[model samples]
Target: MLVTHERLAELGILYLEGTSVESIDRAAHAVILSGGTRLGYERLLLATGARPRIMNKTVEPKSRITTLRTYADAVAIRSTLGPQCKVLVIGGGFIGLEVAASAVTKGASVTVLEAGPRLLMRAVPALMADLIRAKHERSGVRIVTGANVKCIDVNESCSAVFLEDGRKHFANIVLVGIGAVPNVELAQAAGLATDNGIMLDETLATSDPDIFAAGDCCSFPHRLYGERIRLEAWRNAREQGAAAAANMLGAERPYIKVPWFWSDQYDETLQIAGLFREQDALIPRVLGPRGQLLFCLAADGRLVAAAGFGSLGAIAKEVRFAEGMIAQGFAPKPEALANPSISLKLLSSQHRSSL
Candidate 1:
């Protein structure tokens, strides 16, 4: 899955090697490159992406205390990790949890800490978060939430994590997964409007009409949601990039793809479709030879999101149907959705028709 420079070169793309944009001169409608190259474009698309959110601004990461964001990070973790290794992971989000699970698999004793009250508090519904947290604990992953890390004492031999509540944890390796920061320095330097990210219109164009942005670096108005949202996922980035390209070419295409994301921990495949809130009504459907399928419905009765934990094939099959229901604002009957016997595909189709 990830597209490489060689792959793009094969696809008739001119890959500019070692070219860096220093600044953008909007008056001249050109980008100033570091190598004294001025590249002019009719329409510019800034897909800068994002960077990993480190533990602290004051503390610098060394061998023992670091983060897992790149291939090199994985290598470092693997090299240092072994049986009976005590690993301390900060943040109960997806990255931290995933890393903890992987460490546990490699026979490392793992402990994860989250500042928030619950795991994936912003991403998934409360019930789902609880279920997933319980599952992880059962699989030998120690999790702690509402933990305020005051300081970190790092030395060559070991690193100690100090909390404000007078708790200290010493570990062999520390992996931080607080979150990510949008790489918007270039956009900011170019004088484009930015808040949490580069602000984009429904067409994914930025404040400057000639320039556009997408992926994790830009926040665009959501068609289904009435607010501006930025999604950092492989599917979202890929789809938004294509949409931006089409819009830049004078083909008026609005990005209306329902938010979809997935993660794998151990043998289970967790997949989610559409954006779900904690207040959404969760309807669990027990299925055949698979785990439960949880559907999240908004207050207005529209099916907004669904999460599946079981067979990857079953989750993959349900993704499209779930997306359609959310995009169409289809409100499936609670009776139909809660029933275990009714096929999810059929339910979605019927609910969509009812709308």
Candidate 2:
């Protein structure tokens, strides 16, 4: 379904569809090879995204088991499913939980099996995970925690998952909601420096000064974490994309933004404004059912990260406060952050000398 120039002219929008890069030999001064193939360009910016992780040993690469990574995957899953289907999701991370909730709303019986003890164990706090457990179960989604799957038996029509505890769950459909790995084979094959991902410095410049990489495919130095970290969130990707573009224009800018990620499952929207270090302690502050913020404090008493389940506005305020602290090189008292209504403007003006 490649929307050609003629086809695009017929419609209101300039749509280009199904035109594989193999056929389209583009020639330009600055070419961006989005789908591979050489586009003669002085500068190249690679922003290839990541793909979902699914093991063949656990699930057979058949029609029954699927990974919801792209739009095509979502369409395939939705088209082949019905209200009477029983969907067994393998992972209980953000993707797994969101898919299970969507499936349940579509009248399918969904059961989420997570190997970890709690849902979203790596992202949210323990108490927030418990709250999410209650929310999922209340919406007719059965969740099984500490579930280790041994194998997946798949026929032509369906699949039956076997657990280590000898429990078998029959499923008309199965979805693997695990994490993703960066698409850096092209860079690696080209002899570009890559460690875990395409290694880029603070300026988003790859090992090759003429080449720059961004988005999930490149691992750049994060000032907040004081190390090279890869972020897969949309905001990070967009910022990295813009940074790569700016660097290509000879702008001397470095990528030093804080990492943030947000997820929406059913009625709950979780927003995390920063990354958490391993030694950071969690400070829980519950502001009612609709608002709660978890502050991750560093050893030196500075707020490293702030995670909120239902408090989007509060998360923004905290992020602003953190950014201000970074500008002044001053750490605030951990106890002072307890007040939700604390004014960021006042904090920025009054704390100038101390910072």
Candidate 3:
């Protein structure tokens, strides 16, 4: 739905629809297709993306239990939701929370189960997570942390989720959003180097120089963080696709774009830019009653990341400025960043002027 096949064709793209690449013959620089067709490429870019992580392979029901990944899966989930429906989400991450919010909006009774001590444990700081949890709770979403799901028992009418702590919850529909696994089977079979994902250099090239990988399927080095990172965000995927194409055409430019992610649940928008750790020094900037921004600084006081939570109008521009600061490696005074009276735009401009 994002783009039509005709639009892609107009861009001089072949637009292979429903065709699967059976195997890659790296030695011959060609890929065998599902119908025994051989397609040779001067440079191959793999944007295979990722698949949703399954909670329990054995306990998976034929119906009722599902994971959201494709548009079809979303439609199926939406069809099952109603005022009388009871929805159980088995993760407290972005996808699970977002689904829970949508289900609540649809008049479904929603409950979120997080195995971790808190929601968004790996993504955001505790302060922001707490605020997000409060907002969801206020909106009638029941969130249970430290919930270790043992298994699911499915019956005709409903499913019973059993926890390791000897508690049970029942729901008409069970949605799992634990995480995702990068699709690297083809790359791995081709003897390409892969750690967390298809290993790519700054130029997005795979072990074979002619082969490149992008999006959620590849892990590239982050020059700012000095580490390898694989982002599952859509913006990261879109930007990486462009970068990979340019590199494939001999642009030879390093993919050094700042990491950015955003999620919308209910009426609130959460946006984050750059990579940050829980241990990073956080500086808070208050934006009236319903908005706040947190800046994460490294031990050396480098502006590593920023997260904003509020209405789109309240935080979007500020977060964008913070993203530029992170990208430029600007280390503004902690006091200046914490003061809401001072504009982030002004700070960024001043930093650039000083340089």
Candidate 4:
């Protein structure tokens, strides 16, 4: 999704097309393609990524409703949206909000419908969600939460979204961004272990020792989180791909990098580092170069995650220290965290670990 064909060609990369791997014969150490081609390999890495999760099967045939997954999907969406176009976004996750913000920028009338009670319920804390919602509202976007979308009715020209609460929103464009489904059909057919994603070890190797996986398609044990997680961020995928490649070459290295993600809507830059989902409390710190800092602290007192909105320059700094604290399982007093007098560096140094 990040690279273009022209760029790949410029880098002297051999880009293959039309050849699809039908199945993998692990016993024979070969992959059979649809064109009756069999390729043998000593090691294999699966970076299959994911597909956009379908919110409703009934609306799959609707031409107005589009799921943002590929560059083509974005092109199709932009084609439908124009000035004064009523755009209805389903699923208020990252993709939905981003699409809504972009639609607003294009002079489209945007309305975001989220089934959950809060925006970005699974991704960010309630406080951050509130800030994001307010930010979008100020940008002239209508965000409706606790909206239960029953189904979509489509016609020759426009479509209407029917909600369970007896509300119907008519729109010329619909964007779905609920979640993603890991592309694990190949791994499942090959008898490799599978969960919500392909299961892998800390070394990023699948159950089959010769088969390794990375990116959004694989869930590996995280030594830091004490559990397994499948990160969908571009940075995480890039780092994991490199680590998996090195390990596939017989360099045994565990993929234990700290997890982080970022989002940009309007003029604000939002960043989250480490496991923010586990935080029990929010600590607001006002010691950044451009904006205030909101720290997500676990119940045990460690800074599990942190987000800085405003200057990308300052957010980069806070996110770095937050990563260090998360790595050492560092815990500081809430007062210390809220106090701007104590920098994140001081807090990290005062933690149990020397680093």
Per-model TM-score, in order, reads: 0.93, 0.83, 0.97, 0.91
In model 1, what are the clashing residue pairs, if there are any? none
lDDT, residue 16, model 4 = 71
After superposition, candidate 2 runs with Cα above 4 Å error:
1-38, 58-63, 79-82, 311-330, 341-355
> lDDT (0-100) at residue 285 of candidate 4?
83
Best by TM-score: 3
Candidate 3, residue 168: the lDDT equals 94
Candidate 4 displacement at residue 347 in angstroms: 4.0
Q: Which candidate do you rate higher for lDDT, 1 or 3?
A: 3
Model 4 Cα lDDT, one tens digit per residue, 1-355: 5689999999997667877888999999998989878888899988999998876643646555678988888898888777969999998988999899989988999999999999988767777788889889999999999999999986656788999989999988777898899999999999999988999999999999999999999898988767889888889999999999999999999887888888888877888887666536888887555666788777777667787766777667766787888776787778987887777777776674554
- Give lDDT tens digits, candidate 1, residues 45-130: 99999888866632444445778778888898888877878899988988888898889889999999899999987677766678
lDDT of each: 0.83, 0.75, 0.92, 0.84
Q: Name the runs in model 4 displaced over 4 angstroms.
A: 1-14, 287-290, 349-355
- The model with the greater lDDT, 1 or 4, is 4
lDDT of 3 by residue, 1-355 (tens): 6889889989898877789998899999999999999999999999999999876632645465778999999898899899999999999999999999999999999999999999998778888899899999999999999999998987768899999999999998888899999999999989999988999999999999999999999999999999999999999999999999999999999999999999999989999998778567999998977788999999888899999999999899999999999999999999999998899999999999999
| Leading candidate by lDDT | 3
> Which ten-residue region of model 1 has the weakest summed lDDT?
55-64
